[model samples]
Target: MASDTNELFPIPAYCKTIVGSEDGTIEDSPLQKLEISNPARILQLCEGLTDRTTKKLEIKINKYLQAETDASSVFMINLLTVSEEAMVQVVGDNILETSIRTPLSEDTISDIVEYKDNSLKCAEKLDPKLQTLINEIVTKDTGDLNIVPIVAKERRANIPKKTIVSPVYLVCFVNSSKDNRYITTLVHETFKYCLALLLNTRECEEERRLKQQCQSLLAVARKLFSHLGDLNDLLKEIMSEARRLTNAERCSLFLLDPDHMHLVAKVFDGMSPAEKNTEVRIAKDQGIAGHVAATGTILNIKNAYKHPLFYKGIDEATGFKTRNILCFPIRDEDTIVGVAQLCNKMDGHFDYFDEQVANAFSIYCGISIMHSLVYKRIQDAQARSQLSNELMMYHMQVSDQDVADVVTCPNSHDLPNFESFSFVPRRVFHRETPCFVLEMFERLDLIDHFRIKRDTLARFILYARKGYRDVPYHNWQHAFSVAHFAFLCLRNFQLVEKGYLSKLEALAYLISCLCHDIDHRGTTNAFQQQSNSVLASLYSSEGSVMERHHLSQTICTLNTEGCNFLESLSREDYIKCLDLIKNMILATDLAIHYKLHSRQLAMAQEGFTRSNPEHRYYLCSLLMTCADLSDQTKDWPETKKVAQLIYTEFFMQGDLERKMGKQPVDMMNREKASIPDHQLEFLTECCICIFRILSTIFPSAKTLVDSITRNIIAWESSKNVFDKLRVEGCTSYDVLISEELERQVQATLECMQDP
Candidate 1:
C-alpha cells in the first residue's frame, strides 16, 4: 500500500492497449497525404489579462504535441488568465494576423475593446473555426489525454475532382494516450500542465514579495530598537516609517496620556524641524487620532473635513488642509498604547490593504513604545536557551558496548510471554528489559523499515531506561510494561495489516509508551504546583503537567547526540510523528482520554473509518491508556502485587502530606483508606470500562476484559474478608484476602480437571 496519496500522483497509465478496440486494418499512407493536428493553445487563470506571458508555454506544448501525432500544428492558440490569472490581449495590427489586413478596420478595434466575463464565452468569441475547444475541454478528465486519427477525402487544386482517403492525426501531449477521443482532450491536457506551472511560478513570485516585505519590516524594527534609549529619536523613526509604508503626506504618533486623558506626540511629520520637538496634545475625544486612541479602533476616512469626528483646529493652526486620513490605534495586546494618524494620502485615499501594511508596522511601533520590558524578555529567552542546553547534560549518551550488550536479538522461545498481553514486565530484570525492547524492534523490523541506524536505536533504548526515575510503579519497569502491551496489540491484532495504523503512528505509539512516564515523581500532578523546577514552570499552566513532562523528556532524549533515531525521516514525516507521540502520551491522562474516547466510541458504534484522522487519534489514545494500565490484564497474583506497590507509594505521599498539615485524600491516607473499596471502585470505573471499550473496537482484546473481570472478583472477595474481620475485631485482612483468592483459583482448576 502507498504511504500517502502524494506518492501516487505521477504513476502514468497507457490505457489504449487495454481499453481501445481493434476495428480497422493498419495501413501506411504517403507522407504528403497525411496531416497531423495539435491544439496546443493555453488559457492562464489568475487575475490579469496578459496572454502573451504564456507564449513560451504554447511553444513547448506544440512541440510535445507534434511528437505525439507525427504531424504539424493545425489549430490556432487562444489562452487567458496569464497575468496573475488574467486575460490581456495585445491589440493593433498584430491581433489581425487571422487575415493579415493592411490598415486597421473599425470592426477590428471594436473587437479589441470588447470583453468577455468568463473563459467559456471568451473561447466561443474567438475565431469561429475552433469555437468548440473550451466545451470539449470541460467534458473529459484533463489528465486522460488521448489522440484520435480521422480519415477524409482530400483533392489538390490541380485535380479538384479526384478523391483520396488521407489521414489527419490529432496528437495530445500526455505521457500516454487513447484513441477515438475528442480534440478537447488535446486542448485541456496540453494547457492543464503548462498553465499549472505558470500558476506555480506566480505563487513563487508572491512568496518572494512577502519575504522582501518581511526583510523591510525587520530593518525598520532594528532602526527603532536602536533609538529606544532616546524617546525623541524613537518617535521620529516611528512616524517616518509609518508615513512611508501607508503613502501619507503627513503622519503623527500619539501616545495615550492616561493621567490627563489626552493624546501626546513629541514629533510631528508635517511640522518644521524647529517645531518637531514640541509636544502636541489633543483631547481624548477631540479628533480622529483621539477617537482611535480612546476607542482602540482603526479607521480610514476618505474626506477628513466632512467627518463629524474631525477636529479642524490643528489644520487651521498649521494652514494645511487635510483631504483624507487613515487613523489606527497602536496596541499592546488589548490595551491601547498610542495612535498613528496619516493625513492626505498621496494616491487617492487610504484603503483596507493599506490598513494591513500599517497594522504590521504597528507591531514594531508598539514594541518601541513598550521597550521598557520587551528588551529584557528577549534577553531572558536567550538565557532560557543556554539553561536548556545545560539541562541536556543530564541526558547522558550510552557507550557503544552498552548498545552492543542489548543489540543481539534474543530467542523468542527463551523469552516467555514476550508477545503476550498477559505478560508481567516487572518480573524481568530492569537491565534485561532494554534487550526485550530491542528484540521487539527487530521483531517488527522497525530499525530497518524506518532507516534508524542500529547503534542509534540501541542508544535510544538505553537512554529511555535511564531517563526514568526509580519509583514504585511509574519507572522503567512500568514504562517497559506499557510498551510491551502496545507491541502485542500491534502484532496480534493485525492493526497495520487492516489499515488501522500507519508505520509512523506505530513507531510513535511504541516510543510514547516507553517514555510516557519518564522522570515521573511517583506522585500526582501536585509536584507541578509545589515544585519550582523548569519543567513545571514550562508546562504547569497548560495542564496535564505530568504527561507533558513525559513528552518533554522523550524529546530531550531524541535531541541528544547518539539517541536521535528519527533524524532519517523527512521534515514533514518527522513533525507528524512527533505530533502523534505528543498527543498519544498526553491522552494517557484519564480526563483527556474520556473526552475523546466517548465521542469516538459513539461514532464507532455508528461505523468507524480508520481513514479519518480524528478517529485514528481517538483509537491511538485508547491504545495508549490501555498500555498504561496493562497490569490489570495480568494474572491474579501479579494484579495483587501491583495493587500493593501502588498503595505503598500512595501511603508514603499521605504520610508526607500529614506532616505538612494537609488533608490527604482517603485513597492515599493509609488509616482512612479501605483497600477493597478503592480497588473495586478503580476496577469497575477505570480498568473494566476501558478494557470493554477496547474489546468493542478490536475483538482480540476480549482476553483483557476476562482478566479484569477476574481481578474484580478478587477485589470483591477482599471486601468480604475486610467486613468479616472488622466484626471479629481485626483491622488488617488485605493479605489474608489475597491468599483466599489463590485458594479459590486452585479449587476451580481442580474441579475443571475432574469434569
Candidate 2:
C-alpha cells in the first residue's frame, strides 16, 4: 500500500527492507529495472514519410524534355506561377495524362506575395542586365525551366562567384533532346547514378549522427553510474550533459522535492556561487518546467520573453539573459520524475536533433536521480549514526558519576527570590545554578507530582546545559536564564493551579526553555542557511533549523543513559510531552513568534478558554516567547549587558558573513547597525505586540510588560547618545555600544545605590 505522507510516494516500505535487497528491488537499493549493469537505449519513435515525389518528378521531367512542348496534350504538362520579382515554374508529374492542370492567373502573383516580398526587395537592387533578362521572361510569358540557367548567369553579372542558384527543378535534369535544350547536356544513365549517390550520402550522414548520439549516451551512462556520491554533484553532471547535448549556454535541473511536493531547482550551470547555493521552488504547474512536467510535452521556445509563461524574475535575480528555452520532462517508467530546462542555444533555436538528444538525456537523468536518492538515504543514515556517536563521545562525555553530587536538590532556604520575575541568574554563584534549577522542579512539585526521578532530572539538566555551546548570548547561561523565567511564571502566575496550564504543560515549558538553545553556534537561522551548516541542511526545509536542533538535542539527552526523565510518564503523556516540547522550543524562534503574533493577540482579546486547544497552544506559545526574551525585561544594567552579549554575537556572525562575501542584514551588520535604534524597533515592532498580548491575558504579567516598557525608554535615550557619538567620529558602533554599555551599567548601579 502506498503511504500518502511518504516523501517518495510509493516507496513506503523502503526503509523496512533496506538491507541488501528484497526480491532484488529494495527501495533503498539501485532499481532492478534500471539495470545498473546495462546501458540504456533511447526508444526509437516512428519514422516519418519521405518526400519521394521528387523521384517521380525526375522521371516525368526526363519524358517532357525528350518529347515536344505540350507533349501531353490532354493536360498542361508545365505550369508557371509568376510574382512581380520572380517567376517560378512547377508541374505535378504525379498526375496521369488525362488529368487537367489549373491555369495560373494574374491574381496568383499577389496570392504568393509572402514568398516574393524578400525576393522583390532584393531584385530591386539587381544590375541592369539581370533586370532586362527578368523583364524579357515576363514579356514573352515563357518562364520555362530551361531559361533558368540564362536568368541566373545574367543575375550574377554583379557578383558571379558569390551567387549560386539552388535547382529544385533542374539538379538532376538530363537533357538528351538536342533541338531546343540548353540547360543540360548529360546522357540518360548518368543522372540515375548521381541521384543514387545523393541518396547514399544523406543516409550515411544520418547514420553517423545517430552513432555519435549513441556513443555520447553510452559514455554519459557510465559516468552517472561510476560517480562516487553527493546528489548536488550528480545534478551538476546532469546539467553539464544537458547543456553539452543541447549546445546551450546554460542549463538547470528541477526535481520533485518529495517533502514539499513541488519542483526545486537543485543545481544550475552558469550561475554565481550564492545563486547556485540558493534553492528555488516552483509548483509542478507554474513555470516552463512546470508546463513540461504538468503536460508531459516539450516546449521549444524561440523568444523566451514573448512567451506567456516566461517570467524575468529568475533572469533578473541571477543576472542571466534568456533568449530562448527548451524544456522537457524526465520520466521513470510511467512516472514523470522531474524536468530539464535548456536556455540560449549556441547557433539557433533548438531543432529536431537537439530535442531528440535532450529527450534521450532525460532518461539518464531519471535513472541517475533514482540511484542518487537511494545512495543518499543509505549514506545519510550511516553519517547521522556515526556523527551522533562521535558527537556524544566528544560533547557529552559526562556521566551519572559526574553529575551525582550536583543532582541532589539544594535546600529551599538557600534559594531565595526564585519566584521573582526580576530574578537575574548572573548574580548567583555559578556552581549553584544547576541545584537552583533542580529546586525549581522541587518547588513545582514536578519532582514529586510527576514522579520525575531526582537523579535523572539532574542529569537531564547537566546534559542540556552541556548541550549549549559557549556562545556569547545563546550559551548555557542564556538557556538557564530562560528556564528560570519560565519557572517564575509557573510559580507566580499560578497558571497550573488556576487551570490555565496543566502540570505536563508546565513540565514541557520548563524543559523546552532549558534546552532551546542547546548546541547553538552563536549564529542566527539565516547565518546557518548562508553558511550551509549541517544543521541547516538537516532542518532548513522544515525551517527553524537551530531551534529544531535544540529540540533534537533535548530528545537525544532524554534518551541518553540515566537521563530518560520523561520515561516515568505513560506513553500518551510522553508523546504529548514531546509534542509540547517541540512546539514550545520552536516558539522561541522569533520568526515564528512574529508570524503567530496576530493570532495570539486576537485570542487574548477574545478571552482564553482552558478547553480550547487553540487557546491553550496560543497561550503556551505566548508564555514561551515571553520567557525567551525575558532578558529584555531585566533592570537597565542587566538589559544593557544582555544587549551587549546579543549584539556581540550578531556582529561576530556579520564579520563571518562579510568574509564569505555575503551582506548580513542591517541588524547583523556591526558597522551599519545602530544598536539602540534596532533594539527600539525590535521592542516596539516585534516584541511589544506579544508582550502586550500577554499582559492583556494575565494582568499580573503586566509587571513583566512594565519592565520591558521601561527598558524601551532607556533604549530611546541610548539612541540619542549613540547618534551624538557617531557625529563625533565613531565609525564602528557595536564596539562603541559595548564600551558605553559597561560604563552605563556601572553608572546605573551607583545611582541606584545612592537612591
TM-score to native of every candidate shown: 0.51, 0.59
Best by TM-score: 2
- Once superposed on the true structure, which residue ranges of model 1 sit more than 4 Å away at CA? 1-397, 409-414, 530-534, 724-755
Residues forming the 10-long window of minimal summed lDDT in candidate 1: 84-93
lDDT of 2 by residue, 605-656 (tens): 9999999999999899999988888888888888887888888888899899
Single out the weakest 10-residue window by summed lDDT for candidate 2: 37-46
lDDT of 1: 0.67
> RMSD (Cα, Å) of candidate 1?
28.3
Model 1, range 12-106, lDDT digits (tens) per residue? Answer: 23212221125332223332121122221222222232344433433444554554543333222232111111111111112222211112222
Which of the numbered candidates is closest to the native, going by highest lDDT?
A: 2
